[model samples]
Target: MEFKNAKEARQKIREGMWTKPTPGLAYGYTQANLVVLPYKYALDFFIFCQRNTKPCPILDVCEPGKYTPIVTAPTGDIRSDIPKYRIYKNGNLVEEVTDIKKYWSEDLVSFLLGCSFTFEKALEDANIPIRHIEENKNVPMYITNIECKPAGMFNGPMVVSMRPMPKDLVQKAIDVTSRFPQVHGAPIHYGDPKKIGIEDINKPDFGDSVTIKEGEVPVFWACGVTPQAAIMRVKPDFVITHSPGHMFITDIKENDLALF
Candidate 1:
């Protein structure tokens, strides 16, 4: 189904019409990663994002117990607007739900983090091929040897999303993405996934793998999923996050976040 705007897309998700990974939907609008935590852990997590801007760039944060993202999408409800949500208890993923209204609490806080998906439209506009989008699959993501700066009880390896493109377009891809710092600007690593601790490019820690065509090299970008890695290591009592590749579409436009 094609959506004319972010609001229409989010409404469909809220009504259970779309229950898959969101990549090409709401073209030109921003897409965000979600992290819902208890109020007690909010400050520390916010600081963690501040220290690791590439992977955890803040888009909009809801007040404790609030589900609406007043800044990014005022009409959207974080609990129901996302296609899928992961529920974690003691850091273990316990359930994947379409909506989190049942888990709502007065003590929980919602954070919207910039997603790489937001910059994909720009990449496509520049004639850069996005493999997973072409294959109708989720973007491949992996945990790396790169450790994030520790913040309070949160500290873990950075997670990255990979896209393989023609070797010649690597520099152009970097230039296109570098303009959007809020959506993980630029490629962190363009070749040799092993150098970043990825044992096998085919087996990603999250999301799905796509074809790496001949003459193409895999490029990696800091992923918003990094917080989920920290949540797993820290084993917080309870938390909620958007399922990998399932993001919340926002009313904000892509160019609004670009440097130029």
Candidate 2:
């Protein structure tokens, strides 16, 4: 799909012009993971994020009943801007649709979390290859043995995304990505899947795994999926989120998320 600008892309979503994965859109803008819950769960979820800052780093949160994301986006509408959304009923994904107008509720509270896309741009800047992007697939995520610090209703194993790179570029990629703490800063573990409880390097818990070429090491970073894993385990009666790879693009630029 073609978009004159980021706002226009979101407008098209509001008009139902697009309904698919959202990578490669709005080139430099930051795309975010979304989590919407009943107002009754917002406070606990907020604290969950506050405590587990890496995987759940928050960008902005909309007030209950507020469609506008004032901090990261001023004109975008959350209910329709993302390419697709997953609606959960009592913790199970009951539906995956292009928009959530039917699920929109006055009592829903929206939270926007930082995405690895924020740091992928940096990897590209440093000449590090992102295999999933090359293969046109979603970055692979896995539920790890690492546990998030629980807060009220939120508690589960930490989740992470993997990217394979040549041994030489791994350090450079790590140094570059470490500068972007808001979007999962650096590699938590590398080379060995056994260290993180991953039994098979080719098998991932979420998204499609890519080829790891000879001499390349598998690198893992905290993933936005951590919250989704948390949600699925507890099975909340009602929860909503952006479909994987279908993120909400914010007005904020990628460079704005960097720490220098």
Estimate, for each residue in 201-233, the C-alpha lDDT of model 2 and write its tens digit: 888887887999989999998988788888998
Tens digits of per-residue lDDT for model 1 on 101-213?
99999999999999999999999999999999999999999999999999999999999999999999999999999999999999899899999999999999999989999
> What does the lDDT read for residue 169 in candidate 1?
93
Q: Clashes in each model (backbone N, CA, C under 3 Å)?
A: 0, 2
lDDT of each: 0.97, 0.86
Listed in order, each prediction's TM-score against the native is: 0.99, 0.95
Best by TM-score: 1
Give me the displacement of residue 17 in model 1, in angstroms.
Answer: 0.3
